[model samples]
Structure formats: structure tokens, C-alpha cells
Target: MSEQYPPPPGWSPPTRPPATQPYAAAPAAHPQQRPRQQPPAAAHKPGAIPLRPLTLGDMYDAAFKIIRFNPRATVGSAVLVAAIAMAIPVLATAALGAALDLSLATELTSGSGGESVTTSVDGADIAGIVGVFGSLALGSVLQGIGLILVGGMIAHVVAAASIGQKLSLGQAWAATRGKRWRLIGLTFLLGLTTAVLLVLYALSWVVVVMTTSGWQVPVVYGLISVPLFAAFFVWFWVRVYYLPVPALMLEPIGVFGALGRAFHLTRTAFWRTFGIALLTFVVAQIAGSMLSLPISFVSQAVLLGGVPGEAGVFVLVMGQAIASVVTAAFVAPFTTSVATLQYVDLRMRAEAFDVVLMQRAGLTTSGGNPRP
Candidate 1:
């Protein structure tokens, strides 16, 4: 105190005495105060399909939205596939017709006897008929394969769109590369099952007719079996209506596993799934018919305008092919998108898939924190 030295160079002492001002206390934060929490950033953007739960309308809208989101991969792929499918069948039929015509002309020009002409015509007709059917069957199989491929591609696009990602045709195809064979196998299995069921039903009717006599017996058998068959059909359809294609593409499951998974997911939600699927089918069919009706009408008019027989046939075939292509381009994507989004909806309702989707979408941070 005796040395109360002056402040160091360039530093001055307080102008007033320390005791002249009372000590002020620091303000305290209220104990109950909380750091304000900002509302969560949305997981999806407006006008985009959400990854969470969806309504039927949401499913429908999402379907079309996804088609709009990537028409190149969805509608473009469908058009390409449908054109190839229709073209193969049309060309094969044309070739067979040409061959048949050539054989008929050859027989006529050779001035063969009636018997020879009859025999030659019969043989050629049978061969031509078989060839036509064979070509048709082969074309159908290829078309089925193409449809499966398109479905798989649509599934991939819809899935990526869920996570705010866009997929080109090549990218979607790449994503589904591994599942292509599985999809084809699944389709074959489904068709085989349907054929077996039809055969069994037909056999049952035959047995009823052969083993019993009178209208009453057949009528009673039909009455008894009809409801049972319908029930069985509904059960089978509800259980397997949603194919494993979406599951195979989106999940890590194999073909059989995806089938089992589909069954499991629809077990409790059978009616819901059935209703939605039925509605979607009806809507798609109606839309497709509307799109193709004009083309069909124009073709019919052209045919009625006195075009040559062969030319009229060609015009009709070409017209139908074009209609098929257009209808397929618009309708196929809607169906696939509905299936895909419905699959997601089922998974979310049954398995909390929204959480996983959110995580994938980066809406949540690591350790379960919502992003600020």
C-alpha cells in the first residue's frame, strides 16, 4: 500500500475511486430456458413423392409423378420394348403369310389335279398355321420378358426418386442388372401356376361331366365349385398380386425370398392390397383404351375405304401395333410405378421402412439425431 505505484507506461489509473461504483452482478440465464429448436428440414420436397406413409391418391399421384420424373427411363423404355415386341410378332406373321401365299400360287400355277391341289393346300395350310402359332408363342414370350425388364427399370427409378435421386435409363438398367433373370423366372413361374390351375379346373369339370349325367349334376357341381374356385382365386391373387420384382430390385432378397416376402407383407393386408390393385388395373385399362380407341377407329375407317385386302390387313396390323406402343408407353409406367410405390407403402406400414428411407435420404444425422 505504501508503494501504491502509478500504472505502468501507457496505462492510466481509474479516474474515480474503486469504491465509487458498486459491483454489478452478471445476468443469469433462466433455468427453465431451452435452446430453441428449429423445425426439421423436410425429408421430401413439395410436389415430390414422400417416403413416408401414403394414401391411395398418394400412390396414384406418385405413380404418375415418377413417370414424369424420368420419362426417358420409364415411358421411353416401355415404348422401345413394346415396339420390339409388337414388331417381332407382326413380322413373323407376315413372313408366314407370304410363305403360305407363295405355296398357294405355286400349286395353282403348276395346274395340279384337284386331289393334288387339295393335298398340297392342306399340307401347306397346316404347316403355315403351325408356323404362325409358333411365331406368336415366341413373340409372346419375348414380350413378357420385355415387360418384366421395363417393370424392373421403373422400380429402380421410383426407388431412386424416393431418395431425391434421378436415374437415367442406363443407370436404372444397371441397378436392376442382377435381378433380370429372377424377374423372368418369377414371370415364368406365375404363368406356369396359372396354366396348372386352369388345367386342373378344366379337368375337374370334365370329371364332373363324365362321371355324372343330367343337367342337374353338372349344375350342382358348377354351383359348388364355382364359389370355391373364386375364393381360391381371390386368395391366390391377393397373396401374389404384388410381384417380387419390386422386392428383388429394392431389397437384398433373392427371387424365392422376394416371393415369400411379398406373401408375408400382404398376409394381413390382403383386402387393402386387393382393392388398390383392382382399382389401379381398372384405371390403367380405361386409360389405355381411351388412348388407343382413336387409332383403332381411324384404322377401321381406312380399312372400310376400299383399300386392297392385303393392304387393309397391313394397315390394320400397323395401326394396332402403333396403338399398342402408345398405350404401353403411357400405361405400363403407371402400373409399374403404382406397384413400386405400393410396395414401399406396405413396407413402411408393416416394418417402419420410413425410418430407413429417411436415413437413406439424409434427413437424419448419425446417432439418430435429426439434422438441424
Candidate 2:
């Protein structure tokens, strides 16, 4: 303390602070930060398809899924329908074949002393032919009716499946209960219209033939007009008429209403609809052909090769019928699904039907998560 005095002219003492202040104030206590929240998971796929506008691949995949999920409703119904449809024709053919055995055999004399025999058409043969044709027509009508019913059932199944509800065959049939006659009527109307068009087409060909001078002119005209008309027909049919079946099956509307709806739906997306339909048809055709071609060949080899005459023919016909049944069983449901999905896709695009589907599926709520 005594020596604390400045020893030199410029010397100064060190300064000291009060002891109250800590060496370093504690780091300002940071308020704890809460964890950040993550967004909810993507929309849950409840059934065969996601609740959104579907791509072609999605439609195709979902079609098979629908068939797989509701086999009794889809594939089983298809099998039953196809079997019944085929049965009518088969029974008719069998019955008619036995009943209408052509007895009009004519014996001809030949210079080589070898007897030549030929069949001459008489009134009984004509009656038999008419009966056979009538039976065939009846079978065709029944097949058409069965197809319509099956399509309606498939539509019901598709509707249920879109909402994650799997339907049984009974449920599907019940859903399509009141629509059967309407569907058949629609089909008949459509068929009648088609027949009229075909008649017109034939009449047009007759006109061309009558108007043209020679075979070459008619041939050239046919070569040109046939393809053009065929192309136009295919295009028009795909764009306009192809979707009416699904429309009639799914909606509460009648045949004309369905036709109008389909026309409207395809108006905006012709190429897309056309592409999906064409591709689906091509795939179904290829698959059916692949399955049936082998059967046909094998049946011919087994039935015709060993058996003789009418027996062989009968066996071959039966075999072919069975093949058709199997092919229809596998192919029908798939085609039906694709068609229904097309209707759905079109509705979703045009009507925001996906949101309705999601809501029905319980995949959406006001909150971030789905409602419990």
C-alpha cells in the first residue's frame, strides 16, 4: 500500500471492478424449440384403384384387380353367362342336327359305272334349314341378352369396388336387378339400328354395282369405298357408340340418356378414349386368340383326326364351343372392367367424381388425417 504511489512521472495504477459481476453471464437461456410437424401421408388406396383420375395403365391394372377382388361377381358371373349363352346354341345345334338329317340323296349314273350321289334341296330340307336358322337366331338373341346382363353385373361390381366395397355375385345381381330389361331393350334398339345401317350399306353397294359399267369399276370402287367406309365406321363406333354400354349399366339413366352421356363424355377426350378402348380390345383379342388357338388346333387333331364324318364334326363343334366358353369367361370380365373404368375415368375428369369417391371411401376429412 505504501509503494502504490506512482514511481515515475507517467506511471498509473491498475483499476479493479466490484466482485458482483460473474466472469461471464450465463448464456441467455434459449427457449426450447418444438419439433416441426410433417405433412400427412398421401391418399390411401382403399381398393383396386387410387381415388384419382386414372391413367390407362392404372385402368388396366385396376381392371384385373377388380376381377381378382370380386371373382364371384366378375369372373364367376362371366363364366355362368358364357356357359348359358353357349349352351343355347349347342343344344339347338345338336337337336337340329339330329332332327334335320338331310334325306334328299339323289343317285346319278356315270359312264364309268361308278354311282355318283348328290344332295337335292326339297321342301323338308328348306323347312329344316329355316328351323336351323331360327334356332341360330334365337341363340344369338339369348347370347346378346346374357352379355347385357353380365355387363350390368360387372358395372355394379366396379361401382362397389371403387369405394373399397367388394361385392358378391348376389349383391351384384341385386344391384343390377331393375336394369335388366332396360339393358336388353337398349341392346335390341342398338342392334336394330346396326341392322338398318348394314342394310343401307348393302343398298349402297347395290347402287354402286348398278351404277358402275363394268366389274373393274365396281371392283375399284369397292376397293376404295370399302376401306374408307370401314375406317369411318370403326372410328365412329369407337368414339360414339362403344361407351354407351358402360353408361347404361352404371348410371340411373335410360338407353338414350346413356348414349347422350357417352357422346358428351367422349367429346372432349376422343383420342384418349379411342386409344384406351382400342388397346384394351387388342389386348383382349390377343389373349383370347392365344388361349383358343391352341385349343382349336388340339381339338382338331384329337377330335377330327381320330373320329370320322359327322361324329367328328359334332365333337369338334362341341370342343370349339367349350373353348369359346372358356375364352369368354376370361375375356368378358376384363373387357367389362376396362369399359367401366373408362366410364369412371371420364366421369372423374368431367365431374370431379374422384372427390366423391374419396369421401365415400373415408379417405378425406376437414382435418389433416382421415376421419376415424
Winner by TM-score? 1
Model 2, CA-based lDDT: 0.76
lDDT of 2 by residue, 251-284 (tens): 7899899888888988888889888888989999
Clashing pairs in 1: none
Worst 10 residues of 1 by lDDT: 102-111
The C-alpha RMSD of each candidate to the native structure, in angstroms, is 13.3, 11.3
Q: Residues 1-372, candidate 1: write the lDDT tens digits.
A: 477766788986545535755864445758677457867655453334676678898888777777887889999999988888888657865776665532333334333453433224568656765665565567556766797899999998988887778899999889887788888888788778978998999999999899987899999888999999989988887687465778888888887888888898887888888899889889999999999999999999998898754455556666777888888888889988988888888998999887777777887765556678
| Candidate number achieving the greatest lDDT relative to the actual structure | 1
- Each prediction's TM-score against the native? 0.79, 0.76
